[model samples]
Target: MAEEVPNSSNTVPIVGPEFARPQPSDLTIIGDTVKDTDGNKVFKVKTPLFGLHNKRILVDSNDSPIVTMKMKVTSKHDRWQVYRGSDLDDKIFTVKRPSTVQLKTRVEVFLKQNQTREVSCDFTIKGRFMKRACRIYVGDSTKIIAQVHEGDDRLVATIYPNVDSAFIVTLIFIFDLINMAGTGI
Candidate 1:
């Protein structure tokens, strides 16, 4: 039988049994991030920009646009939305900071399919923007799907192979925005 545990709020029960972290071999991410200038940093993945927009895009090994991220200006939450393609309507998720008064950045992700403000988080990104560190978990579960750490000049992200690279990229971009906002730089 599967085990059912209550969530952080202790309101709704998490549906299924707990999941174990995937083995490193099971990870599909290339785990590469390189610098675009000076060659001081090494990136396992390549992020190349082609056009102009408030947002930026990153291409995969096939040169396909995998993730497009843009920040929203008018929202009180200071939101950033990540789409699967160039089209903003093809949204995968939105990351928003709680408010400006807090010290450590608190970001919540709401998937396009689950737009309810009251629903438990579809995925929660927890980390300190100042430290340039963060981890993305699968929904409310403790299973981490991706993570990022500070690098020489660039941020390094580790994405689980089974997860979408674009999704991971968006998470990293969200953290970058938080770092910029939190530091007031």
Candidate 2:
């Protein structure tokens, strides 16, 4: 028997319906290009070589900016904020570790509307970064929206239906940055 995917109604699509594949979609991220399982490029990551603050832009196949992720330099938990398109003021969501002293890699996401108090997370990411695997769940629940694991010289993300691929990719990007910082990379 095949495993069942979580119901799609439980989550919101960040980018749009077009990015929410009806079936589980696998994407490979190598360097800047994000390609589907069939090897067709779907998205691109634009990283600036030199900047006082680390920032990255996720662009679609047409080179249109989907989201911009930038790290908060003063955040003890290594927080990152994602904004819609290339406009930094149009913040969409934020991702940060639950605690700065955790032994394992764990992150929590909050939509822009929920950032004021942040009493609860909109989503949670838990896994072992050294193992190169993680699962993104809805809030603190077990309803997984996506899973990511390391691939040969790249990372592979499997996003379930109704979940935005760009959102998942942005979370994964933040996850990578957090772990890289931990290793002094």
Candidate 3:
């Protein structure tokens, strides 16, 4: 069952509280390892060097599969799907650019339950990737759930309390994929 955060009536718990810290948490992604402020490895990303779909798997510190993200090859908007626990059939959400062309980085996220209608985004990310700054907001509202910024040697994400860090990490992974492909990184 999902636990709701107090006063956040519009938000849904993507994962659970175990993924969230009581205070704002700083997660740094360096190479395959995602570390916390105390330099503890929290997650790892397994990316294929050569693959048709550019599939990437996120694993926990204990090497358990958390989620798998893959780009949709035929998508014009740079769409991607995130699946639960390495199962493609268990798609949890979808992420994509709002348009094929944009002045800055803009992404829309739709949870599995919202994909049928997709009348509006369940969450949105907006910012400049070159500047290494972006914010994830609740639906179309300005209630920010997480924010990402460039660190000295890696990208740093500051996830707000009670928000699912795994979900934020997944979004950041997709954001990196979209921007890096554009810059040929």
**Model 1: per-residue lDDT, tens digit, 1-185?**
44223233322112111112232212222234433234432213333355433465655445556657677877777787777656777876777775666677667777877765627667777787468777777676776766777655546566553454445555666566666762211
Candidate 3's displacement at residue 10, Å, is 8.0
Scored by lDDT, the top model is: 2
User: What TM-score, to 2 decimals, does candidate 2 have?
Assistant: 0.91
Tens digit of per-residue lDDT, candidate 2, span 102-181: 77899999999999999999999998857767889888887788998887888889898778898998888788778767
What TM-score should be assigned to candidate 3? 0.88
Compare candidates 2 and 3 on lDDT and give the better one.
Answer: 2
Q: What is the TM-score of each candidate against the true structure?
A: 0.65, 0.91, 0.88
Clashing pairs in 3: none
Rank by lDDT (best first): 2, 3, 1
Local accuracy of candidate 3 as per-residue lDDT tens digits, 1-185: 44223244333457545786656678998866889999999998787677654788889999899999888888999998899887889999999998888889899999999988888998899988576678898887877888888878788888877678989988887887797773321
Poorly placed runs, candidate 2 (over 4 Å): 1-4, 8-11, 182-185
Clashing residue pairs found in predicted model 1: 27-161, 28-161, 29-161, 32-43, 32-44, 32-45, 33-43, 33-44, 33-45, 34-43
What is the lDDT of every predicted structure here?
Answer: 0.56, 0.84, 0.81
What is residue 14's positional error in candidate 1, in angstroms? 20
